[model samples]
Target: MLHLQHDRDFYAWANDSAAHLRAGRWAEVDVDQVAEELEDMGKQQKHALAGHLKILMLHLLKWRYQPALRGVSWRLSIDNARDEIAELLEDSPSLATKLPEIAARRYPAARSRASLETGLALETFPVECPFTREQLVDQDFLPDESASGQA
Candidate 1:
């Protein structure tokens, strides 16, 4: 039970980190490097890291392409990411562990939309780059209180 809660908390934290990054909090950071780091993590670590990456990428898309939603603010993005990741984690047991690969496969489609928004001839979304588990965890950017009970 404790482990389960920890997993949940970790997932939530990851989602929030992603949201922060999307909101330009971590501007200039490379998402792909983050993703690669996540890919190298162990299963448990990967789960948590993936949660963060998904939130970040999702919010990035929302920010770049969905102007109406951008007015909603970063806090809302964090909250929404938390809720969305929670549901996704609950529904798909292996989602966290498999997120990097899943994301890689989805990158092309996501990039196309991003290109339209940036008006750049880039093949991928610069801000939507992947991140590693070590980078996410080591950053210690999220609220520690949120992971307290779970950890």
Candidate 2:
């Protein structure tokens, strides 16, 4: 009939958990809930990282495959994604090791999005991600019309 604080009010439960931890009330703390929350937090970080990577990859695809459409807006989008990804990595350095896997996993969606946005054939893009971790984060690493763009 009655739900627990965690199920009824997440915010209240979180605050209560914090208070319990602060007061060293080990018995009052919900260890299982806290562990689940922590695991969820890590998942959220990974999702954020994948999202940024997808945006960066989609824009890079547009820039490379449709050079004429390239302009300031795309550049800014790419830069902003890179900056956000960098900040995420800085806050959770352990996530840096997961970049390659995340990129690979997110690439197909990025490619499909690029194709839809640009009206380009999905086949036009590579099946696998073309950019490397170094290039993805480099502020000046815009792929050129003729080749991979660089500063």
Candidate 3:
């Protein structure tokens, strides 16, 4: 019956599961489903972190490679991504350990996205990620305009 509720109405299942756990009604709790949901929630956080990193890196790529086009919109986008990344890390400090890997894995996509958005050749971006993990979340770390396509 609880399994049915899980499939039919996830909101009810989640609330009921919490109630069961809180009330010491362990037998009524769908432990497996709860565990799956918890894992998925963690994955969602990681995915969000990856997404913000992509946005940050993309704008930085555009800022560096197409300095002529830089504007407040790009700066705001970078600042917002950094704020989001900082919040996510603060909420789950353990995720900080995975930042380098996530940044590396997400950079190629970000680079390609920057190229597509900026109308630059994909090769205009570096084969490797240019910013350090520290620089990525640093609010003041915009790449030098002179660095340009030398990436």
Candidate 4:
């Protein structure tokens, strides 16, 4: 009934846990560690989604701010990020409700990254998110500074 110490050899612990699970050795399984691993997996997925959103928002900002410099690569990067976000949401439907929350939280980091990468002053981008939830995820959405704001 002794369990492998999770900190010492996580890989061994995982393998041993799986084997015990398959053998129906319920009492021998490391339930606490198993639960922690499952929780970690969900957290990883959320982090990944946030990361993709950050990249998407950054590229969108770059595309809007430097329209003259916009090229195929920027478009492709945006498309790729959208596709990834779509895939993640499709796989985890529960995330649909979290999209706005996640986007709101991650947008600042995205703006900061865009400013750093584009060599523009941080003040160039708005402190508040300029894009709506719809615009953030819309494949065709690109901010138009001409519509109402300065580019």
What are the TM-scores, per candidate, against the unseen true structure?
Answer: 0.37, 0.93, 0.95, 0.84
Candidate 4 C-alpha lDDT tens digits along 8-59: 8888888888998999998988798799899998888788889899899899
lDDT for position 45 in model 3: 98
- Cα displacement (angstroms), candidate 1, residue 41, comes to 28
Q: Per-model C-alpha lDDT, please?
A: 0.50, 0.91, 0.92, 0.84
lDDT per residue for candidate 1 within 1-151, as digits (tens), equals 3234335685654665567688887753345545654676645544554555555544555454444445556446556655555566566556656655755655555556556655656543443444343222222333321222112
TM-score of 1: 0.37
Q: What lDDT score is found at residue 144 in candidate 1?
A: 26
What digit string (tens of lDDT, one per residue) describes model 3 on residues 42-141? 9999999999999999999999988899999999999999999999999999999999999999999999999899998999898889888888878899
- Regarding TM-score, does 1 or 2 come out ahead? 2
Q: Where's the lowest-lDDT run of ten residues in candidate 1?
A: 142-151
Model 4 lDDT-worst window of ten: 142-151
Output the better candidate (3/4) by lDDT. 3
**Model 3 TM-score (2 dp):** 0.95
Q: Could you list the CA RMSD of all candidates, in the order they appear?
A: 19.8, 2.5, 1.8, 2.8
Model 3 regions lying over 4 Å from their true place:
148-151
For model 4, which pairs clash? none
lDDT of 1 at 112: 64
Most TM-score-accurate candidate: 3
| lDDT, model 1, position 115 | 64
Please give the distance, in angstroms, between residue 122's alpha carbon in candidate 2 and its true position after superposition.
1.1
Query: Clashes per prediction?
Result: 14, 2, 0, 0
